[model samples]
Target: MSRWFRVGALASVAFVLVVLGAALRPLVLPEAHTAASILNAVEIGFAQDMAAHHQQALIMVQRLDRGVDPTVLRLAQQLSDAQRIEIGTMLGWLRLADASPLSAHPMAWMHTDAATSQHHSNTSHANSDAMPGMATTAELDALAAARGHNAETLFLQLMFRHHQGGLAMARVADELLTSGPVKETARSMFQSQSQEAGVISVLLTQLGGQAPH
Candidate 1:
C-alpha cells in the first residue's frame, strides 16, 4: 500500500478513536456495563481472540532477549512488558463480563463468511487461532533455534509482520466493538503497533534483513 493510503487509514482510525473517547463518558463506568449484564458477540470475540494473540507475542519476545544485540533486546523487553500488561487487561474484561476465555469458533468474531471462520479456526498458530500476524509452529520453532545477529534480524522481521497483522485486527475492533474500554484498548493497539512496525522495519533493514515475505 502507498504511504498516503496508510495515512488515510489511520486517519479514519483516529476519527473512530475520537468518537469512542466521547463515548467513554457513558461507557467507561463498569457499573453501566454491569447493569447491561451481558457481553455482545464483538466484545466477547475481541477479548478472547486478542488475549490469545497477546500470548503468542509473549512467547516470541522471550526468544528475542538471549544472545541478541542490546537494541534488539531492549525492544524485546518492551514488547514483552507491554503485551503482558495488555493480556491482563483483556482477561480482566472477560472476567468482568463473566464470559468464557475461549470460544468454539475463533474468527467468527471477525464477521467473515463461514468458510473463512472455519479456515481461521483450523489455523494452528494458536488454539483460539484466528489472527493474521501469529507465527506458525514451524516459524516459532525456527525462532527458538535462532541466535545472535540472525536472531535479531529474524525477530524484527517476524514482529514487524506481527504488528501489521495486529494493527489490522485492532482497527477492525475499533470499528466493530461497542464497549468503551474495548474501543479505547483497540485504539491504543492501533497507534502503538503502527509506530512499532515502522521501527521494526528500520531495524530489519539496519540488520541487512529482508522485509517479511
Candidate 2:
C-alpha cells in the first residue's frame, strides 16, 4: 500500500474507535423510585417549591463573588458552590418525578390547611416571583455596588436571613416529604443549612454585626 493511503486508513480507524468509545460511555442520571403514599401530590409540590427556594439562595451567594471583604467573599464562594450542587440534586428529583420547578406560587405546597395548622396563623401571600429567603433586587444591586466592610456586613446579614428562610423550608420538607430519597434530601438540607447558619452567626458576631432578626 502507498504510504499516504496507509496513513489515511490508520486515521480512519482511530476516528472510529473514538466514536465507539463515546457512544458506549455510561449516562450518569439521578436514580428514581416509587413514592410512598404519604409522598403524595403535596410532597412533590413541596420539593418543587423548595428547589426554587434553593435557587435564590444560590443567586444571593453568587453576588458575593464580586465582593471585597475576604471573609465574606470566601463564605459566599463556599455557599454558592454548596447550594449549586444541592440545587442540581433537587432539580434531578423534580425531573424524575415529572414535577415543575416553576410553581403557581412560592410556598404553595406548604399552604394546605393541615400544614398551615402546624405553624403560626398568618395569611399566605401568593407571589410566584418571590423566593422565601431571597434579597430584593434593590438589595442585591446595593450589595453589588458596595465595597470593604460594608459589603461584608450586608452579605452576612442577607445570608443570615437567607439561611433562616432555607431552614424553614427544610423543616417543612422534613415533616412532609415521606419517600426515601425525598426524606433523605430534606434531612440533609436541614442538617447542612443549620450548620452553615451557625457558622454565619459566629462570623456576624466577629464582624461586629448583629445577625438578622
Q: After superposition, how far is residue 59 of candidate 2 from its true place, in Å?
A: 2.1
The residue-by-residue lDDT of candidate 2 on 157-192, one tens digit each, is 888888876776677667776657777887888899
Candidate 2: regions farther than 4 A off: 1-39, 65-67, 118-131
State the lDDT of candidate 1 residue by residue for 1-213, as single tens digits.
699999999999999999998889576754533366566777788788888888888889876648798888988889889999998988888898888887677766776554344434433344334577788888888888998888888788888878867876777777676568888898999899888888888888888997774
Best by TM-score: 1
Query: Which candidate has the highest lDDT of all?
Result: 1
lDDT for each of the candidates? 0.79, 0.72
Please give the range of 10 consecutive residues that has the lowest summed lDDT in model 1: 115-124
Model 2 pairs whose backbones collide: none
Query: What overall lDDT, based on C-alpha atoms, would model 1 receive against the true structure?
Result: 0.79
Runs in model 1 deviating more than 4 A are 1-35, 112-129
